[model samples]
Target: MKILVPVKRVVDYNVKIRVKADGSGVETANVKMSMNPFDEIAVEEAVRLKEAGKATEIIAVSVGPAQAQETLRTALAMGADRAILVQTDAETQPLAVAKVLKALVEKEGPTLVVLGKQAIDDDCNQTGQMLAALLGWGQGTFASKIVAGEGSIAVTREIDGGLETVDLKLPAIVTADLRLNEPRYASLPNIMKAKKKPLETVTPDSLGVDVASRLTTLKVVEPAKRKAGVKVADVAALVDKLKSEARVI
Candidate 1:
């Protein structure tokens, strides 16, 4: 199996985000960047497939600015055979991203394409489906469990009601969920090895995909802070507060 996984660079989860003064985007000035959490899960899953001998090659593909090479390196350290960075400076929306990935898929001719269900920053949850649509291939999104077969794969999907299983043939797309697998840290040795791996860079223009933002982020503001509450001294006071003051009862 030739598995292609798309990774993303986003602000570190622990870092506090500040909106840009012009309200165009988030402030990246001096902010720490890391691989998106969900993308990490997708990378781990792809590596697992390779370790199990189900995958013959794993390529980590990242679409962003030059800084996105860092995200591809992170995936390579996790065990990808190679990396591809589709260089784009503009903030790409789901439609644009899907188009670029589609071009790569045609070029690589991979059997499987795995990606995160959504990018942490945008939470769009649209790329995987869009890619599948663009390629006219089937998709298994929010996959909690995956088992490879001779020619098809069995995947368990997490939905609103319950888990559902489906068998998808090769040349399919799978979007990973949180419970897919626990991502491993890239050790120092792997980091050194990743630096030596073959990383091919391409531009969106080179691939004939126009990089334009269809969705615009008008404004971003911090969510209102939650109010703090005091604990009642005893059960009687709690009951009184709920019944009289709060008027819940």
Candidate 2:
């Protein structure tokens, strides 16, 4: 089985985000960037599957600006056989990314596709489902556990009340959740080897997918600062304050 994993590049989670001065978007200029955390879990899972002898090859893919090659290299260092970067400077929304992955799926003919549940930068959480729908394939999303069988994979996913398990046939999609697995750091040797791994770059136009943004951002602004809390002397004072100031009573 050939497992394909899609990764994303985003602002490092540790960095404090700053709104652009013009209310355009978050300031990414000279900001530290890294692979999406959830996608790292997805890549680790695929590599484990290959190590377990259930998968023959693993491919890591990313859709973003040319800088995203670094993100794909991170995946290759994690044990992916190769990497593919769908180069695009435009904003890659959920729908456009799904279309690009769909085109790659057709060309690569992988048996299974795995991706993160969401990218931290956008937090849109729509790409995996959109890709599954476009391909008309079975989907098991937010998967915490995955077991591959003869021609299907059983996925245990987290739900509102509890966990739910579903069996998806081959040529299906699975989105990795937080508890799926802990990601492993790339070793120095592997990191050096990743530099030599085949990293193919293609344009959205080459994939025949029009990546024009359908949604427009009216404005982007920083959230309002939270107000400081006030202390009350006793329960009676708290109740009075709630009634008069908060109006909860």
Best by TM-score, which number?
Answer: 2
Q: Model 2 over residues 142-214: C-alpha lDDT tens digits?
A: 9999999999999999999999999999989999999999999999999999999999999999999999999
Residue lDDT tens for model 1, 131-225: 99999998999999999999888889999999999999988999999999999999999999999999999999999999887776668877788
lDDT of 2 at 64: 93
lDDT for residue 196 in candidate 2, whole number 0-100: 98
Candidate 2's TM-score reads: 0.97
Instruction: State the local distance difference test value for candidate 2.
Output: 0.96
TM-score, candidate number 1? 0.92
Model 2 lDDT at residue 161: 94
Best by lDDT: 2
How well does candidate 2 score on lDDT at residue 153?
A: 100
Q: Which ten residues in a row have the lowest lDDT in candidate 1?
A: 214-223
Alpha-carbon runs more than 4 Å astray in model 2: 247-249
The root-mean-square deviation over C-alpha atoms between each candidate and the true structure, in angstroms, is 2.1, 1.0
Indicate the worst ten consecutive residues by lDDT in candidate 2: 227-236
